[model samples]
Target: MRHRRITAALGAAALALGMVGAALAPAQAGGGHDDGPATSYTNPVTADFADTYADPAIIRGKDGWWYLYATSDPLVEGGEFGLMHVARSRDMVDWEYRGTILDEGSAPSWATDTSFFWAPDIRYVDGQYVLYFTVTDTELNAGDDSAIGAATAPTPEGPWTPVAEPVVPPRPDGGGFFWTFDPSMLADDDGSRYLYYGSYYGGLWVTELDPSGLRAVGEATQVAINDKFEGAYVLKRDGYYYLMASSANCCAGPSTGYSVFAGRSESPRGPFVDHEGVSLLDTRPGGTQVLVQNGNRWIGAGHHTVVSDLSGQDWIYYHAIDREEPWLSEPGGINRRPTLLDRLDWVDGWPVTRAGAGPSEGSQTGPVAGSLLGLTVEDPAEGRALRGSYRPDVDEQSGDHALVRGRVWTDEAAPEEVHVELDLRTRRTEPFLVRVGRGSNRIEVEVNPGERELHVEYGHGRFQEETTVPIPEEYDLSVWTALQVHVVEGQVHARLSESRLGDVIAEVGLELRPGILRSAPVELRGTGAHVDNLSVNAAHEPVAEMVAEPVRGEVLVEESFDDAELDGWEWVREDPAARVEDGALVWPLTGADLVGAGGSGGLLLREAPAGDWMVETKLTLDLGDTEVRNYQQAGLIVHADDDTFLRLGHVAIWNTRQVEFGKEVNQDGFLSWGGHTSGPPADTTWLRIHHTTNDAGEHLYRSAFSTDGESWRWGATWTLPAGSDARVGLYTGGGAQPETEAVFDHVRFYDAG
Candidate 1:
């Protein structure tokens, strides 16, 4: 005869790393555990490299040292100085950040002092290291002549000598070959060297270079061209040449669309094939493989150059938009893309990703549950019991007995009804009733009336239903939670227990409360009972708390190019649509531009933008639709203006498409930042903002999903950034919403904390 309890069930659901937990298996045969290299999620430097730098280049020199070169600052929007930087990694995981390898100070006379560096293709040719790169016009107004150039050095890092003039054809009249950039030099297995260049509408082209690796020997042939692409990196594996390039609009803070796409050709140059054999120049899929994403050790990783480690394993060197400095989606901010590196696991001749499949969950922050609640197993195979103190209501009208015990009933128990004999023998003269209740958050089930009969109640919120059970045989009450009770109010209140309402129904039982006649020995009993992971109703009521707002403040901005006065405030990069003069920031256009098929732009300012702050930025938007997808309005942000900041932008998604007809989207149109929650057509809108904190110590933030930015309603609220006192800044980006561009006029802040 097996005595079992009906209420010993545990909730089977557990969440791990934002994913659902799988069912557990009975003890496994432990012989196959690998004892080599103990590794866990805590292991640092496991998978840390990512993204491409502007115009990447690499070479394994004769001296057994591997050198990599990249063009500097293609992504920097208006910085004064620029130079070539280098990094070296022997194992590929540990890298030494070597400073600037080359600069305008070392540039040849043929190249202007203000020429910006593009891509640098380096190789060990003959007895010297030949470095080939492109130099662009400086004035932002000087169109193109920013063509490719070259230099030579005896070693990887050197006191170098510049080769005279541009190595490739000079920029043509109109847009000069879309500005020659992304140069790659490949030494074929057959002892021949070739240089690849040309981007934008000009496509991919390859020209033969002499063994010296400095000058082009023959005319360059058009290789491939289609989707205005750049950052071309060519590699030869298994007798096939693979051309990898960066595709799509790759800027803007939290809102960026950047990825690497590839095409393969049997020859060094020809019709390259994508997955569908569609000419890569015409129909390459919008980047099939994602090297990295947000919440990883690396983010905004693209524009890469792949190199071989000393062990022959391929390592990709690229730049990642540092989590500290996110890409601004809005206009009023600087455009900056940093360099980062990572290894690409290749199988079946294609690059593979261990991104989501790695041992530890990617770098996203989550709720903190310090330790496992002190839970114990009452029955090894089926039941687990959680122990805690329970205070109940008792009366003094009857004998010296006032207590109640709760128990659960579940399918895991062998008997139809669990035998619960309470330890009432300790007080033979005292009479008590036990009660039980069910449910997790709120208990609805309860039982009463000891040896004579038992009563059970089931209900929650407002609706409740109950039942009763009768007992005949008399056995000494065992000192256990399985069957215990105390008499208090004559009505007999049931002990509470709880279960998750979304799934199974949970049940509980408790003894009724009988009055106490006199003071007696107080010994707690019925403590080890198997109860479902349900909630137990309490005899006493609880108190609730109110919600509050987060605190905000001001400080100087870091990671910026500011060298002005420190008057307790910071100046932001100039907005492309505005002129900065006097003490005030002014804009030529009244509204932000909605970048359509081509794209849009804008910027935002930041005094000290991080930590948690309720930001209210005023934007003047024009309600018009862009003919492209995902394009919307200029956005506002808090947290440093880096790629990691949060965005508060608008949408013209609800705007009519007719507004973009007959003309291109490069004009001035004004649309107020109204609360428009719908898709597009976000014209004529007002703005409202809100941020708050909860009792759980978490910050909640949200915006108004309204038409008028003023008369706004609440939108979605998410957790705040995870760090100590950070900064805040403005943001603006291009999207596929309805508008071409959105503008910002003014912004204000408040201390919510």
Candidate 2:
């Protein structure tokens, strides 16, 4: 059920022989160090459907529920089967894996013969629910034309019944074989239904569906035929029809690769060309826009589906090999492709990944499992006396070890470096190093200590053992560090952090095993180091904290905000023009408080908050010009602790005709209050905000605006670090049409969420 792997710090101790040979090696054998803790999408809001989903398709039903369908292992099986799984969610983030919804084994006679059922798309047509999918021949890779079938049900998850025979038949072209597969359907304004289907082979082809919404109306027309295409999607945007498809090889795990391509045409059928003027049918690399690439942590990314949100934002979902997992044994090893999903932003009508920006820090923010991979600890646990063993005869409970103050230890030298080679199944992000003690001194493998200070070390090892190489002390890391191990010459390294430096750790005279000694033996001495917030690289951005206190170590705030003493901080008016009473900053809006004709004003200070901190403020606004000043705002200044900070508060004015209901305010000048609004504001509103760093290099500035101060909602999330010297202050400046003052109250800052 829950598959896991151990940290791969020493496994690379073995050569890249076949999987079996590496598996049998002793002491850091089997390229074991090459496997590191697996990092998935970490943002809870964006990570959904955390399962081995393939050929993913999502459709929103009229009932407001979004249904997700995937073509393989819907019920969590180890082997491949022609079964489609189902999942549902109201918000795209939290998906409830609903097991199997459709299976081919129980299919109608016409479909039972097919084994490979793939790319299922659901649509609602004429008060009826339609499911379109492709079923391949039992030969699998024989590449013969497959049949497109139709099924219908009232609900999204269906005990579906077949509507009829193949909706689209095999190709009539004379290319030896017409492989029909991966079908998607879209309805046009004139009541015409179109189906787009194709494989990674020939190209994407389109056909008209009969009014009954089953079978082809006539001969299928070749629409877009790019050789690098597969998993095609058709949707209409701004009156123009678009076909989105993935190009290149896919389903190959870490090596699996492809790029999303797009083509536009007036009609859903006929000659479709990419933006580069290349024919859709031609297999070319440069013909399509590269939406994603492989490098650093992400080796392969492609095979995607795009979905639009309530705000018109489109999201892209695809599968990629979790590079942290090594290549599977031969054919099956490279086939475990993990699904990856990210939000897509449209720049000039062209889709691009908002999170994927090459292999750089702050390029992506993914989700993680709700719980750790069976490992338990606090936010900042240390690694001391932590020993792991891979003994063939040891049991799980027996070999398990605990990290103390961040170190592991052993009385005598073990045959291997700690127990790194024992349990290769557990994956951990906690930094661990082999440490062995030798009387007066100890040795270490320079594992990341999670601090910015220089860590002492010796030697780095590649999987190849031709020669044991040494590394200079001064190891630094962030989110981009790859798994690495250090080897000592001569004596087999013992202890979790102990290593025989041949001439360094006592003249290479120690026996490799425990309870044994050699006059000139080498010993692996030193314990593993485990620290909190240890990223792969050393340059990742920090997490957002309501307040930052370098004096209290790193801002490791994972919960609420409270401080015994508000030390090293000052309470200055967020709005300079506003008055301060009872030691609380307040803004009182008046005619003079309003910016003059075409002018602007609010408040500012000279200095700002340093490190990772967040600020929030409450405000009220009453204004005129209900039409022109609707989105007015008042809020806090982030990045800046003082005058020269970035402010996202309201812009509405004061004293204008208005309407009121409950907490809703309708007026002109100095209207609505709170953060991140552009036009005007409502009357008497309170805006509170939070701005801070994202420790995992999630560079984006995270801020939430709230109406009731206690209940916050996400407003705008962006990346404008502004280099750290930024301060916080209030500012209300907009609309030269007329001016009104906005009021402010209740401002505060804290260390974390």
Candidate 3:
């Protein structure tokens, strides 16, 4: 169900009075926006900016983008429940909604209609993204229907594939006293990962995972005990692992008593003790209180995660009820908790925040320092002034070059003529269009080197007049080119110049229509073109100028595996038979299979793909004289965590050689689905996997295979559950004979389309 506001519209007089009162109130200690004595910020960072977001789990992705994953709005009467929603940010302040991670129809069959997703925790590990989330069935009692599940994706934003079963399923048999929900993960320095979950009934529990982080390996240990506590998060600091959890009811809006408490232990799997030597296991005293409601207007601050800014300052992100807009707390209202952020300071051996004064309100300094404020434009000395919104893609090869990589439009009125220089690199043949106005009343100057022509046209609704000139043979299409367009009186002139030669390659003129208005904005549309310098001049006076600066923290990973060495990869199982030959990774028959006792073969990329990514590799499976077993597979695998993953394999199934797509969830047996079969033999198959999210935010995996590396045949498409951060690479196993060889001809990973 979508979140709905419940407040009644205030009268004009009442609204005016409320605004005047708010303006007259004294500023609190850290509530002023100015660089005053204290730094503070208002509550609900996304209040008026977006829909209500609660239970925020934020992470700085490997791609340098910040991601916020939260529980979707509950289903309304007769309405379908939405999937877990995700929002993205470049600087963590202004956010753009990326869509939900999963939708209704994407969940597994075991998850009944009564179940709803909640509180997701995401982590990037060993080149993959893993998500642990809570799910509860409304059909069962309060603490009886909650469970925890896991999912994986190749990138931070995913088409996540859920593990076939819940990581921690509900015990309908009443085997455990507490509900399994609100999951958080901790990765220790020694390559060990631990999951901390559970609610008030059985206290907060901790269990270790077997490297993959998909399956629990040992018995669960209770670390914190309290009548009203959940959302357990563990943070390791200064040789101590801190246990943080929310206490009291968290979803009751203004009347809620939710707060944050903390305990610490030397070990991640802890016997956590408070500052006063009080054990969290002792329900008689609970953990030490850290943050509580301090001021009016804001209440019930809880369910938090801590992150550090570029300046090395710790900030706690959480959600709280806003009293002024207590729409959710009104009579017969649903809980509406909006996200909030505040600084965390360390005091002695424990963590403290604003002297334990809960959440803050009003203006405050942000966690990060930089701002993306728009450029200031000055008026030109001509008819209608113009401004250019310069966007750049700075790389080592191009140094500092403005990118007209896609369509761009400006609000400034179109000028009669615009002058610009471009560094058109090779491998691109698309024409560049300098358009004025839009739709029917539009005119354009097109420079297409691929077609070797230059033209200028004026028209309405695709009806136009044009003058075209063929490009001179002396002009090199591989280098830079200078272009100009001028419209004066009732004529239009266009020109193009060769790189370094200054030779005019083409020139054209066209008759301009009468009553033409210079009112619409100017636009540039093209692909694979870079602008080194650009300027718009009006009446011979400069109106706009652009200079480029390098963009920071953009590239995550660019691997070719061309050196015939595993430079940025970790072998899941280092079989001595595997070697590099002719720039390809060759895994010889180790007599091992991918299932049962022989299911031990893997090689994972070391860095996780941040947002969306693709992995392509050419594989040749040599079965030798041994017959291909039912599952003798060799191809690519996309791992979410450790235990949950998807394999797009070239295998021998039922005496037929085919490309198969299978999934493994929580160590459950693989659910192999047949893909494109009856193609060419497996000796020279090019396998590729593309993982991305669609417009509706569903995680989609599109697998395809090629015979000659040029033409491809589409295989199967799989929809992942709500969460994903996946690792991708090549794998080979499950041969009937132990001695089978799988050869991979280079593995490539790139950002998805």
Highest TM-score, which number? 3
* Clash tally for model 3: 19
C-alpha lDDT values of all predictions: 0.39, 0.41, 0.56
On lDDT, the candidate that comes out on top is 3
* Cα lDDT of model 1 by residue, 583-694, tens digit: 3233343333423332223444445434344565455565343234333444454443222234455532221210110001111221112111211214443343455544
Query: What is the lDDT, from 0 to 100, of the residue 209 in candidate 2?
Result: 81
Q: Give the TM-score of candidate 3.
A: 0.44
Give the Å error, residue 689, model 2: 43
Global CA lDDT computed for model 3: 0.56
Off by over 4 Å in 1: 1-58, 68-70, 73-80, 103-105, 138-142, 173-177, 283-287, 290-297, 327-336, 355-753
What's the C-alpha lDDT at position 541 in model 3? 15
**RMSD of every prediction:** 27.1, 26.2, 27.4
